[model samples]
Target: MQLAIGISACLLGQKVRYDGGHKASEFCLSQLQPYVRYQAVCPENAIGLGTPRPAIRLMKKTQGDIHLVQVSDASIDHTDAMHQFTEQALPAMSALAGFIVCAKSPSCGMERVRLFNEQGHQLGKAGVGLFTRQLMQRYPWLPVEEDGRLHDPMLWENFITRIFACHDYQQLCREGFSVGALVAFHSRYKFLVMAHSPSAYRELGRLVAQAKLFEPEELKQRYLQDLMHALKQACSRKTHANVLQHLQGFFKKHLSSKERQELSSLIDRFRLGHLPLMAPITLLLHHLSRFEHPYLAAQTYLQPFPEALGLRG
Candidate 1:
């Protein structure tokens, strides 16, 4: 629904890379465009390094400090400048639901940007890009993903779901936070959270149960942190199967024994990887539409992101 996302300009097809090339993601253009309004920024451009400029690299010193240095001149560094830009950018990105960064770039890669020694020898692919490192540290609750990683189904789905969940939390801030609201929000996301981290599922439930004991702002802060952290852990087929079984229990009175058997079979096929998650989810939704199970119907696990994105598929 036009959720605003902060994205690397290059990933959105802007020519902001050092060589003036873009690292546009096909799914972002074809599937996500309609649902999200992107605020594209090129950290290199923001730091006054215009497009077509010389490449920069992360220099890892023996003492373990990494600096964004010019390829030819290690003495020339942009680390501080990128940090200053991040200081300004993050505060202004309150509306952003997530960030999509360029991979293996000095300015925007989320991880594994190559680190080099002073002699220009490759140290390792261990450096997080300058700008993205700050972007994440400053807002650890925010969903940050590299464009390259989005090609994987699990990572893609996790990142997409986290963003939508973050947006929901942000919306609660707009709608006014209350104990009842927080509980309802947590309730809808119960299975979704459990699928990601059962420990977090338990922790968040305890937090919400005692939500009234904490100040409103404190409750919001803690709940949001726990929610995002839980989602950062990827879901397993076992967990999805558990969640599917939980959903199945809701339709017991309504479904005939044959229908129940079919539902269980679909869930098993999905758990075995023979069918996509959508198979069992589709069957569940069919029951959801005709059934009067309000709680099951309200669960976001059944429909996390827009189905058109096909992150699950």
Candidate 2:
């Protein structure tokens, strides 16, 4: 099934911006669109703010509260309307695997958006967008990224990995919650979690070990919260090398001295930034193909997303 992803309407090439222009993402349109279904939304427009509507800004009051108001008139507040819109929109959004938002927007920016005081004095860029803030608070596990941040290779790869993992979990839910299914899901992700966070991997292992002790619903919620939290950590080259080494150990009995040495060298080169991650991973996969181990073969770490994205490079 195509993963369902939520996106800011403007980012999806809809002309719903305050100036009636779209901030279309070429990557989203050309590369990702084929793999997933997008549910586009323009919160401002959904609240009856028409195309070419007056621009809005986040204004902080003396009471230490932020409000979305017209750029020209602070008295013209739309905070209530935006909140209502978000409340209504969140239920349907529960099924989304991820969300892509416009950066620096009063309604959609993920972080570091400009802020103003009641008198319009510039405040530091510390305020989150009202709508995006709520979206995140409601779905803490959902992978949310701003359009600009998606340009960074590591961040892009991380976000894509997360959404694919989330989609898999959603499928597990649809298949009905069972202790065996939960254990299997965690087993597939074992190496992936280790790559991101060794500590989290351990924590998740413990949770999975105790899966049957808790209610099915409780176990699902707790496992997802911890799983998503672990994946959010940045996977450094050092961490990747560690995980790769652990994976290489699986082939110790099968690989000759020359094959083992070659694999180790490739991993070292990757750790030293001389090669992309795909180099070592490709060789390991080739070895796995030659010698089948069901556990190693089932790991999602080896092929987290479609290889066509070439994200590891």
What's the TM-score of every candidate structure? 0.95, 0.98
Of the candidates shown, which would achieve the greatest lDDT relative to the real structure? 2
The residue pairs in collision within model 1 are none
Q: Which candidate has the highest TM-score of all?
A: 2
Which runs in model 2 stand beyond 4 Å of their true positions?
Answer: none
Candidate 2 residue-wise lDDT, 127-246, digit = tens = 899999999999998999999999998899999999999999989998898889999999999999999999999999999998879999999988888998999899988999999999
Encode model 1's per-residue lDDT on 72-160: one tens digit a residue: 89999998998899898888886788999889998888888899998999988988988888888888888999888988878888899
RMSD (CA, Å), each prediction: 1.5, 0.9
Q: Model-by-model lDDT, in order?
A: 0.89, 0.94
- As for model 2, its CA RMSD to the true structure in angstroms is 0.9
TM-score: model 2 vs. ground truth = 0.98
Model 2 residue pairs with clashes = none
